[model samples]
Target: MTDEAFKREVKTLYVAEAEDGIRLDRWFRRRWPHLSNIQVQKMARSGQIRVDGARIKPEGRLTAGAAVRVPPIPDAVVRAPGEHQALSPADVAFAKSLVIYEDDLVIALNKPWGLAVQGGTKTTRHVDRLLSAWGEGMERPRLVHRLDRDTSGVLLLGKGPEAAKRLAGAFARRQAKKTYWALVIGLPKPTAGQIDLPLKKTGINDFEIMRPADAKEHGAEPAETAYALISHAGQRASWLALRPFTGRTHQLRAHMKAIGHPILGDTKYGDAVSAELSGPLKLQLHARRIELDHPSGGKLIVEAPLSPEMRAGFQHFGFEEAEADADPFAGVRRMR
Candidate 1:
């Protein structure tokens, strides 16, 4: 009868004429913006979401009158639109503390490590929830881009729908330049070069990870990263500047590992040296900077200071922060 009731039980409904020929994933997104593309695909794969009593691909088109089956959605994913989660005074202060830059068009945050950009299964505490303290409805800020839970960096948010659309366009058009700094377990052989590799998602159950894939591999997508060796503390570890030309899940981590130099503190893809070098430090990856066309005018360049752990790693590795170029992507061309 109601949306909440639907979340508690499976429902089969016929698609209306207005929704005919729409992609299954898009249909879900129009109804539930909280369900990520990956989440919807996972549901379809597990048969939690079905069409005509059979599992269908996320991209599959739906015909009018088709019976679409939607299983019970998690309460986290079924919140009404524009509803802000109630926040305590402490939560409001915590959200404000992360803000580094803000304007009429956008808000830039120095997202700390171990904080998720959005909510998901078992992810109750995250930036999205924190943002609830800012505002609600059309005036509320919206996420423009995302950073990994363990990666600290410059994260951007839009002031409203129009601003969000413009900011998102920069990323979709590949016009946004992102730079990262990482302490890798071992030195890359070439010292500096572009990693031109394809990657595909692979994992077990709820856990998913990206792995290097052949160009011809099914579902594989092209991924590229240009890196320069800033310095190294012997063969045990190296500090490097990384620029990714394409965005993919775990692109930087997978690229570094593919080259036999996994990032330090990366438990998923790291080597023995990574574990040894990490010790008490977190994943040695930081989104150092981002440059893109601002929603209102000229280029906007923002840089996030290193996390405390990253600074410690620099000291331990005998790497000078001053050695990192302010504009690491200068004169770099996008790899084909």
Candidate 2:
């Protein structure tokens, strides 16, 4: 059947034992990543999506053995299944080298800096394209989350649709805890605190950047970040561990800048002080660690070590990598 025809073909599903207690909206996201929240709500309101033959609210809960009526969803609202892509042996090997953890359901990679997770204008090489190497006769793995093109660290990929849905839910529900490490130009005065700042996107296209939102900005959203100083180089720079309670694009960068200590090497938001810092000019932000619920059950915690450039910067400042192992935000009051 044509792809469009196949997508529009209605299907009924019995809620599996494993999917019990999931929210209705989350259930749909797990099954159809392409469906927008608005689309799902529209379907539910229009009686196109039903559970046990009755229309349900988006936040309605599901139980095992429940019969779900899933209408013919359009192809545009579904994540396209992976297509076969030819990959060179060297490309395949390079992709495999980034794998820090993997299982039947998921693969976690220590994504290198400067590699885009997805393609965009003027961008060609990315983790998504390279994922073709992992196809191995199945659908290409799906991205469960994203890391910025200049940020390096633990990036997760779901092996299939089911796995992708589960992992994505973990992220959306704030069940995932992520730790980032960065080198900032100056130490935050309090040493450990939270930056509760709302942010909104500014500019457009290639020039786009995130800025602290004004009180009256139309689409500004709340953003919060918790940070603790791991070590400092005598006020010149500080090594910090950041935990973002709410994920926002460039939240850490913008929050740090708001506090007058923008992360070193972040050209978009860093200040003149950061620009004056000598040494490698690459962004110093790293996705150091992540903890989340695994699709197959139980908790998964993974860590990615510092890249060579970041390690070199750490060494130059006499900061110990072992210091990062300690909970930087421990005992600090959350600023909210």
Candidate 3:
């Protein structure tokens, strides 16, 4: 990739403007005033700038409005031999836009509504795979936890082995805290209460593995939870802040279904009460906040704002004027 040592510049260059033939780097200098020639020089040294799929010297002159392709600037990624197979720089850039917070060890992203974390037999191009390509040279960051493909926001990834193990332990021991912002049909009657339901994942049903609340008296792991009413009354749907003390597979989804209110877009869990479901939303679940101990020392608290879609839905329900980061449960901590 460093073929442009001497000619450190671009090859297949195109500029759409009507400027005269100016030195390539000089033209770039004027265009991107923030970048210095030295920075441009470094880019040329990397053989990243191409004229027409060819590397050119930095001094090469450019025709006006010519298309110039600059090799993407590398972030703090660990480059590998060929670990980047199907992914492109554009894909990586898009994924980075989803990030809400990041440190050396982890990244918090706003996952869109319809993507999976890990692929099944037929599923491909998951967020996990995309992120795997990001930490390329590094240990290829893996999901420390998972959010339903349809759920959005505050998703976390462990940058390396130590961080990964520490994060996993935090979750297992309930040291990590996850708070979800959800839109459910009808207000929870009590307004605020805990649902200490036991959740299990058995082949229980082909439709879904979630155990029903009526039959929830079987042998299963005890699931503790706390929730508060964000706002409820006239709106057919109510906004809730959900905190699941234990991370169980589909724990929130199943538990919500077990109670009277299933999430808006949960077809699997809402089948029986599907009639209660209304509105254009499919799954109104958002991973609003995640707090965990950083691998290095200090604590980390990452919060994701509501997605555009969810925000619009909230506006439709006349609750668009909600509080931002209104954590009534703020300052709460768990001992590891």
Candidate 4:
């Protein structure tokens, strides 16, 4: 575009609390996806993109309340509130098939194992795309958070932008509580204890993994998980309940590995710990339950049934789901 056009079309936006800490390029892609990565990088390099009135890199992390100057882009297609993509009837039906719970403001899915929450490189079918089929004239479905592709259960979505913003804020503020269930190779030493460890990312993109790190290490982020032993199969395997205080990339998986009790079927972090186990192995981590204040009113609590693989594993280990406590983290104190 010409400089005059760029000058006329340029805009400034403030980062919301829910958008805090995301990469600057990600913020642009979320809002103006037609602005390609190449375009964004060039714009940033040329000082056409600035944060708080100063030039910033595309990969720079954004802070809450920071103002960003966005340059006009060719072929930019920004959607206004209530606008959404159209989906086929088959997609709509597929989206409805996963619904475990929903209300006027929220929709919760019992996301199956191996299904991705968002689309990525070569990821055509995902919860985000399916959401477009969640019917029309509903102010566009929005995901409040994410679950790993291999992880199953309790994937939450908002019916509209307002609801999404509120739900995302609750998560960012640590007000949303999530409980996970995992079948591990062996029992935790104390039976129940907190996995207090700092973590940092290693590798990149699809190959990325989290690793325990010193608190003083650069790029290290605090990660804590309060775990409780629910059931055990002697020294062979154990069913554990996990409550993560801080959400980091692969935090639960890395922490479990750091403690020498990796979740079963997690080949990436488990290091073939389940190699000797009989029968087929699948990632044994499940987001069993979640609790948070509803966008409308009152508390919103939902629980997902165990996945098919988890059921089979439970049967194999003779672990009954009912044996788990009503509130698995009831005795675990909340981290300040």
- Give all TM-scores, in the order shown: 0.78, 0.74, 0.68, 0.82
lDDT values of the candidates?
0.79, 0.76, 0.65, 0.79
Ten-residue segment with the worst summed lDDT in candidate 3?
Answer: 10-19
In the range 91-155, model 4's lDDT, one tens digit per residue, is: 77878888899888998999999888765544557787687566433445777777888999898
Error of 3 at 315 (Å): 2.0
lDDT of 3 by residue, 36-77 (tens): 678788777667676645676788876433346665433214
RMSD of each: 8.2, 7.3, 18.2, 6.1
lDDT of 2 by residue, 1-336 (tens): 444554465655545433445579977875556678998898888989888789999888876446677888655432333422356798889999999999999899999988887654345467877987775323568776677888999898878767876776676565678889999987688998788788887776467787888757875767778888888999899999998876676788888988899888888898776888835658889999888888989998889878876776787778888776645655544365
Q: What is the model-wide C-alpha lDDT for candidate 1?
A: 0.79
Number of the top TM-score candidate: 4
Which regions in candidate 3 have their CA more than 4 angstroms from the true location?
Answer: 1-84, 135-139, 204-206, 213-219, 233-235, 271-277, 330-336
Clashes of 3: 25
| Pick by TM-score: 3 or 4, better one | 4
Ranking by TM-score: 4, 1, 2, 3
TM-score of 3: 0.68
Locate the minimum summed-lDDT window of 10 residues in model 2: 76-85
